[model samples]
Target: MTAAPHVPVNLADRLSRFSDLWSQKTVAGVNDYEVKIAKLKGEFVWHRHEDTDELFLVISGRLTIRLRDGDVVLEPGELFVVPRGAEHCPVADEETAILLLEPAGTLNTGDAGGPLTKAAEPLD
Candidate 1:
């Protein structure tokens, strides 16, 4: 497929295209990584990316990254980078929108594949 050139990606506009929690859609690609967006709520399975860092940027609402030591809370416009191999589970009290950055083929659920795992789909 040919890339859509010169067009800007509007995060909120792209995010509105889906309502499923934990569903990820690839909005753009940067070299070997993909810029993805997801709507999140409740708790996600505990997992970790063994080879690549995961960046979570809150576009709207709040999210808590639950780590073994403690939890990192992120509000709108905030971001957190979970280092490679660091175990984490994301929790949101309310519906939240987020942007994720990781290697193109990185699994959303890491090694803890289950119902929450989502294969990246192209942005519609």
Candidate 2:
């Protein structure tokens, strides 16, 4: 197989390649972590990554991460980090695009696997 060429991972461009909710496409990587783009809608399952922290950066629309304590609402250009072992559920009022930074192979549903869980797929 040929190696992928280095290029910019345009958020809008990468996102347009898929339409499934909760779908995640790996765009790039740094060290042990991978930069992923996901298009989310509705409510995601309540899950937690036992061994890795998950970072969410909102690129478009609004995202609300519901924790046991409260809901963290993120708008465009906003970001939040959910620490390891913290159970949380993500909700989107509308179609939302987000960039996720987490360890490679980290499951989208984390410890709680169900129908929404998906294996990360590389964009290129």
**Stretches of candidate 1 exceeding 4 Å from the true structure:** 1-3
User: Which tens-of-lDDT digit does each residue in 1-124 have in candidate 1?
Assistant: 2247877888878887788888889998899889999999999999999999999999998999999899999999999999999999999999999999999999999988888887988885
lDDT digits (tens) for residues 1-124 of candidate 2: 1125765667888788899888888888898789989889899999999999999999999999999999999999999999999999999989999999999999999989988889988887
Residue-pair clash count for candidate 1: 0
What lDDT would candidate 1 get against the real structure? 0.91
What's the TM-score of every candidate structure?
0.95, 0.94
Counting clashing residue pairs in each candidate, in order, gives: 0, 0
For model 2 the TM-score comes to 0.94
| The candidate that achieves the highest TM-score relative to the unseen native structure | 1
CA shift at 78, candidate 1, in angstroms? 0.6
Angstrom error of the Cα, residue 75, model 1: value is: 0.3
Instruction: Score candidate 1 by TM-score against the native.
Output: 0.95
